[model samples]
Target chain A: MVLYCEICSLPVEFCEFGKSFKKCKLWLQSNNNEIYNKLYNSDIKSSLSKEEEEKISNSLAKMQLKEERKLERDLINLQNSKILIKRIPRTKHKYIVAIANLDLLDPNLFDMKKTCKKFASKFATGCSISKNSEKKDEIVIQGDVADEVESYLREFIDSNGINIKIEHVTERFTNKKK
Target chain B: MFKKFSKDDVHTRTNVKSSVAKTLKSKLVSQYPKLEDVIDEIIPKKVPISLYKCEDKIQLYVVNNEILFYQQFDDLIPELRLVHKYPDAFPSVQVDRGAIKFVLSGANIMCPGLTSPGAKLPEEDWPVNKIVVVYAEGKENAMAVGKLAMSINDIKTINKDTGIELYEYLNDGMWNFRD
Candidate 1:
């Protein structure tokens, strides 16, 4: 069985070649100590000479630094981004919840369709992913479950180690005579 | 070739018919006779296969959300994950330890890298345009897959210039892509 690094998602042996080698090593050491010892403790010297080894390590360090910077930037962007859950009044009392910017949390962890399905089942309402007026994909629920959705999203974000704010907005449509 | 691939590039995705899946399995077996022994294990008969038509006329065969292989034109090139499962099923060459960094970064394999002391090329000459799995000098697993730009014999003799056109490599867009 190929052991993949939980941190980098690369095979354990290839973790050195991945971007998050430091994190991968820590993760492997904690999760699979046997394989970690086999990979890192084995004092098998590389075939490359001193100069080539230094050059490769230097380049790898530089690349890792760049990757770290990029990740920091992404986190900063995430910190600024907010998930908006709008409760729009459709009829006299009926309301629908439209969730926007949920993708900002994390594209990899959050699948819109799956999230919609979860909401549909949990709230016992019809949920779908639809384009908003701004052409951004948003999860539209057919019932007024804004508070429940907000709490669920907050828990989801907190569990994922992300700190993002979820804002609520209520939209009221009034009839007017011209 | 798959450096910039993403989910947005996918145009259409449809379930491959059982008949076509059988033909595909046969085609795969014919291309690499070694796969005959474990083709059933790789792609189970009961599982439904999805064919994703992507940008640049590329087609990807996905089984159970894992991309098994992709087709550019006529050839069905197995992904690195599939190659890792059955390393010996494909024709492969090794590059020197020095070339591993470059290969992982999506650089084409140079003749010198293959002909170097630590590297190993097959004694039997494979013709140009043949797909070959690329392994690092000391690594236990493959790092990339590519097509031969020059025949193996020519690469041995010339020992200069690009020898293989890299298709998919470790950490590239395709390797990191998740459906």
Candidate 2:
């Protein structure tokens, strides 16, 4: 049986409940306990429409293919690609800045009009957006100064008492597909 | 876990209150000086906004919606018109966790946080005030009254704590359409 990745919406297979041809490591579980527990104890299992189930299964197949490709690419890159980690030329940040989270911390709702006002008012370098999986989830801010953004984010989250987990990624990010 | 909030010296970005209420969508429309008059060098004629909504949340469009960019705000309708959809807009509804408040009050508000189509068609860069928790009946299960910090697709891509919070006690409350 195929399950869905809650974050990426790609299909996933639990070693326990899914096809045992491959191992599932991205899951935050040792076994398919979360799925089993929910299935056995929840009200949602009975409501699975055939299409919904198939969608999830299709997602799983896609994910499995993606996993294989990613693994192969990683191996190939390890052998040929230079490991020189790229960094922003930290001379001075530009006046306007954009930041992103690897996990699509937010959807880009920046009021295009206000950019001028805000930029004119503040010393931002460039704008970074939250990164999103290809059409899979919300996009996060984008920025090389992710650390500074995190400090600001922590302040916002802390002051507001928000309980959310935010993460950052290294290496340059690709643009989001519309 | 929540940390202590230092309201006394909350070091915030200068224009960092609710941008919608304080700066962009302020109440006293005439009070503030017209920005165009204030700064002739910058400021565009019209800006775009990304809109978000909460439903079965499919197609996490994280990228591609933000043709316009600016500070985040709290309303989604004004931005809705930018997208070519039904010109008719959905009223912005505020609801407690389960949209418990609206479902009780009875405004075509559906979803745990679902309100309706905002003034804009759905876009990733849309601004928002709250997200609705919706049900299969095409009505709201609850109205999660929180600012849309991210776009509709942005929220869909991640595991939202508010969503987790909404689901925690969603079914426990009884519907009271009194409001």
Candidate 3:
């Protein structure tokens, strides 16, 4: 199997071409010392002349720096984003849980439809992916499982290596039994 | 072609019948005879193949959650990951170090990049429309896969303009696409 760098998700030999070369190098050096030595210590000379090599390295370094900055900006934006789980009172003593802002998470890793199905089975309630007033996709659970959903979402986010806050809100109808 | 592809482009996904999978394996073998040895290992018979019909008539064939190859018309273009697994199975061309960034950005391979001192082309002139893996000057793993826009001889003589129409490359939408 080809060894892949954890940081850049590219083959170890091609890490130099990726945006996170320095991080990939550190990760490889710490995880797989044998492969790291073979890749870095070996004198595999390039065919390009000194000036051409220098120019390419300079441009690559600039591009990598830009990519790193973009990554930092995205992380900051993610930190500001939050998932909101609202428990709305429907009829007498009936409530529904609506989860919003999950799209902030990586859609590739977390599928909204799959998560809806999981919630449906986990709480034995009807759940579906629907668009909210803001035209964003949100999961609507048929019952008041806000607390359960909050804990599950926290676990899910943590498992995916993302740090985001989840807030729970309860809507109180004027004609409530309490 | 797949520079801007995303999950929204996918229209439908269905499992390929075992019989159809057998025919696909044979077709792959015919295209790349070298793959005959490891075809079984690459596409195990027991595992089912998932065919994803995407926008622009592109069809991605996935097995065990990883995309093995994709078809856009008649050619069965191997994904870069698959090419990395069996680098020797496909006809390949190299690009100079300076051209690596452009190729990664989904630019068509220029003739000069292929004929440069750092690059290498096969001795035998492959005809136009041949599918080839693209390797960078210093990289061991293949970075892209594409079809030759012109005959190899023409690329050598003309030495200008587009040479290979890059279909997929490292960090492109298709490469980053996760089912």
Q: Which docking class does model 3 fall in?
A: medium
CA lDDT scores, all candidates in order: 0.90, 0.32, 0.91
Highest-scoring model, DockQ: 3
Residues A1-178, candidate 3: write the lDDT tens digits. 7787778777888788789988999999999999999999997677778898888788889989999999999989888879999999898699999999988988778989899999999999999999999999999999988988888988888888888899889988766556
Candidate 2 per-residue C-alpha lDDT over A1-178 given as tens digits, one digit per residue, 9 for 90 to 100: 3354343322232221232224444343445677546533454332335685566556557666776688789667544532111233232442223332223222233333343244333434433233334432222222344465556556655776644555543544333453
Model 3 CA deviation exceeding 4 Å by range? A42-44, A86-97, A105-111, A114-126, A141-163, A168-178
The 10-residue segment of model 1 chain A with minimum total lDDT is A169-178
At residue B42, give the lDDT of candidate 1. 89
Model 2 lDDT per residue over B78-111, tens place: 1111111211122223332223323322333323
Chain A TM-scores, all candidates?
0.64, 0.28, 0.70
**After superposition, candidate 2 runs with Cα above 4 Å error:** A1-27, A31-36, A39-52, A83-178, B1-179
Clashing pairs in 1: none
Question: Which tens-of-lDDT digit does each residue in A117-175 have in candidate 1?
Answer: 99999999999999999999999999989999999998998899887889999987776
* Candidate with the larger lDDT of 1 and 2: 1
